[model samples]
Target: MIFETERLIVREWRDTPDDLDRVFEIYRHDEVTRWIGMEEPLKSPDEARTVMTRWQARYEKNEHKYGPWAMEIKASGIVAGTVLLGPLPEPSDGSEGRGEIEVGWHLHPDSWGHGYATEAARGALELAFGRYEVPEVYAVAYPTNERSIAVMQRLGMSPRGLTTRWYGREAQCYVTLPRQRAASN
Candidate 1:
């Protein structure tokens, strides 16, 4: 496990078939994919396998406390969903990693309405700000995804208004800066 919150265990995902099957269950749910900008659920296990492989590889390639991590509830040992902290993909405008780190969460619909999303996200934000010293972290969501937007606000992010800065489509951007104390003269 990478880190542990009071109610969750965050860990790197493996590419084994059982783990792949577990992850597929989360990604293949329409309700979960809907908010993630996917119009349809992931259609096949191969598709999920590919995603799992990619995430595992990305985690291995990084030394920073970043990439997609599985959120397993401690008491029940259920894999709730995922929490991610990483550089945003290039926008349609084609700018590369202009130092924008994104924080996001995806929970199975079964896991919704619980505090899991907020708790897992708080762990990711703490890792970004407290450990890596990233100047700030951002979150972007479809304008209509109120549930996700609510999570961002609960994380103390201020809405920066609608923007096309990260994803190709227009999205609501939210940001939070690290509380670094000023140096005394």
Candidate 2:
């Protein structure tokens, strides 16, 4: 497991059939995919496998320091969704090079409203602040994504307004430093 919270076991996603199916199940929903990635839901099992392979490659290349990870509910052993900690992309306008890290989550609709996203994100933050010593983490979401915005607020992230920095489109941005650094400032 990459990390664990009271109710979650955040871990690397395997390339097995079951894991691919779980990825499809969670990402096939337009409701969940609309706020992330291509904004189009997966159309087939082949696409799901491709997605899993891409994520797995990222995991290997980063040596697990950053990438999307599966969020498994410990009580039920069901893979809930994904939690990501990675480098935010450089500004689309070429204003700057990459230097920021981001923390984000995407959960199955069935897993929504159970506080899993928040819990899983807190676990990611702990890993970032503790093991990786990331100075700060950012989260960007569509302005209308109230649920994700709420999670950021719950994590004590400060609103940083809108930017087209990371995702190549306008996104509402929030940022937080490690607790000690935040407190000292």
Candidate 3:
């Protein structure tokens, strides 16, 4: 899927070497990956390639679990990070439609404070809610991940009164779209 923003174009992984390299650069950053609860900053180029291979395979295996898209800047074509809207492998509850579409994003350390994640995420959400017609979207961030939590709040996602421990870290649960108070602008 492809979605556009004023400054960035968010779409599924194309698997070009350059695209793989850009995503690896961001994923390999110790600071950035850790913020997202990734234990290992992305390693070898070959490993990145393997990931892409799997991503492509998922498109056929399960459309709900597609490849994470590379986030590219419109002006320079530089990949800033990744934006993914896919089904949660497992959901907080185990029932029908429990694994609703989830929205997630990651970016290079240099891209921080630039609103790129939020920008790309807005585009992804439009596809999730508008194109796919998902009634709601969720985002979960480690309690220690203040930056991610802040972004979730900016997207108008609110606490859903749930929590979980993931990868040995505490996480906060939040949901957005069709809120009782008001919809996002």
Top lDDT: which candidate number?
2
Q: Give one digit per residue, the lDDT tens place, for model 2 in 3-106.
A: 89999999999988888999999889999999996759998888999998899889888887786999999999999899999887777867976578999998
Measured by TM-score, the strongest candidate is 2
Per-residue lDDT of 1-185 in model 1, one digit per residue for the tens? 77789999998877777678878899999878987877688888888888887787787677636779889999988889999999888776666567789999998888988899889888888788777888988999999999999998788788899987666788999988876211110
Cα shift from native, residue 30, model 2 (Å) = 0.4
Order of all candidates by lDDT, from best down to worst? 2, 1, 3
Tell me model 3's lDDT, rounded to 2 decimals.
Answer: 0.75
Per-residue lDDT tens digits for candidate 3, residues 1-185, read 38789999877777788878876777788888776766687788877787778878877677644447778888988888888777765533433446566788888887888899899888888777776777888788877778888888888888875465223445787888755214667
Off by over 4 Å in 2: 180-185
TM-score quality measure for candidate 1: 0.90
Candidate 2 residue 177 C-alpha distance from true site, Å: 0.7
Clashes of 3: 0
The list of candidate 1 runs beyond 4 A from truth reads: 94-97, 180-185
Position 181, candidate 3: lDDT: 15
After TM-score superposition, the amount by which residue 44's alpha carbon in candidate 3 deviates from its true location, in angstroms, is 1.7
| lDDT values for all models | 0.84, 0.88, 0.75
Clashing pairs in 1: none
* TM-score: the better of candidates 1 and 3: 1
